[model samples]
Target: MGDDLVDLSEMFARFSEHWSPKLVARLNDYEVKLVKVEGDFVWHTHDDTDELFLVVAGQLTIQLRDRDVVLGPGQLFVVPRGVEHCPRADAEVKALLIEPTGVVNTGDAGGERTAIVVPI
Candidate 1:
């Protein structure tokens, strides 16, 4: 591991794209990422692993077929494997995503919005 600290605000300021995730750190097989999002995302599911979302700024709504899970700053939610979910934001939001390395952002949907996570 690197000796320097990872400042989230500084890392977030390095990019301006929406729905794209930037890698910040790694823990064993898991990766910690930061992403900016707005509007609606595609309905998708990760068949093999769960997705963890931790909101850092603004509000995020994880839309499940049954209900919507709303999250704010400092809040987090895990979308289980094989469960379809669509994330929406009325405005821009900054969030941290924790998932196994190589997991695509769009999961099984595989459309234009599928992001290949890059390091910040």
Candidate 2:
């Protein structure tokens, strides 16, 4: 599929669930995932790796112990490794997540919101 291009808009239209991340592609040891998120996500931290969140549409707020980082479309934020953070969205938000392949969505705070990777 080297000649094929993955379209975010088309892929996002096929899924209707929230907080479920769908893997779009892989780059060596890392994976690029798309997630539809609404409401507040559980507080968690990835002890071994940092997570990059890029807002594809709508807005996202990453709550930290000291402050909240708000992001809109085209904005990006990287939560440093071992930093506790909770992601929340006031409305439906589409985002791209970049992290190591085996990293869990909820990190150490695993729950129903912990997404299992679904390759597209």
Candidate 3:
């Protein structure tokens, strides 16, 4: 089981929806997920957990209340707990999200864009 690998290419190929995150792997109590995002995302805050975003392909801009942080491929950014933020992309972007289990994607702002954690 430990020898098994999860291929990002294969997982990304199977999904095309944007903003929806799919579970890729788990370590201890943390979850590693892949998400394809484009356009503007909802502004929200995870009051209890910090969120990590690692850009796998394309570019991602995380909009914070103070300023914006841009991330290219191989780059990453982390939003601290209770910090309000919104993620946006000029084109389709593939990224990896690392956060604790049970942390909702939409954070405190619950709406239709909230991801349902697709399991692959």
Candidate 4:
């Protein structure tokens, strides 16, 4: 399989549900994930790893204690470990998530909204 030819649009077309992350591909020790999101999510932090979020479609608003980040297509951000963050999309948003292999969506702030990490 060609990584360059691996289309995000095709992978994204597979899921229509919200907050459920789909395993996409991987780079080194990190696994890339895709999730369709809408509505508000609980604030949480990954005490173990930095998490990367790349907006693939629609819009994503990330809220922090101090400020908010608005992401559009091609925009990306990294949440450093232990920094509180909540992600919300007024409408359905598609995103590419990145972090170490086995990293949980909610991290140590676990509750619901967490998907079992798939082995690549």
TM-score of each: 0.96, 0.95, 0.95, 0.90
Candidate 2 clash pair list:
none
- For model 1, residues 1-120, the per-residue Cα lDDT tens digits are 255678989988999999999999998999999999999999999999999999999999999999999999999999999999999999999999999999999998998998888887
Best by lDDT: 1
The digit string of per-residue lDDT tens for model 3 on 43-111 reads 999999889999999999999999999999999888999999999999999999999988898999999
Candidates sorted on lDDT, descending: 1, 2, 3, 4
lDDT of 4 at 86: 95
* Candidate 4 segments whose C-alpha is farther than 4 A from its true place: 1-4, 118-120
Worst 10 residues of 3 by lDDT: 1-10
Candidate 4, 1-120: lDDT as tens digits: 236645789877876878887777878998888888999988988888888999999999999889999999999999888899999999999999988888778767788777775422
lDDT of 2 by residue, 74-103 (tens): 999999999999999999999999999899
Which prediction has the highest TM-score against the true structure? Answer: 1
- Better candidate by lDDT, 2 or 3: 2
Off by over 4 Å in 2: 1-3
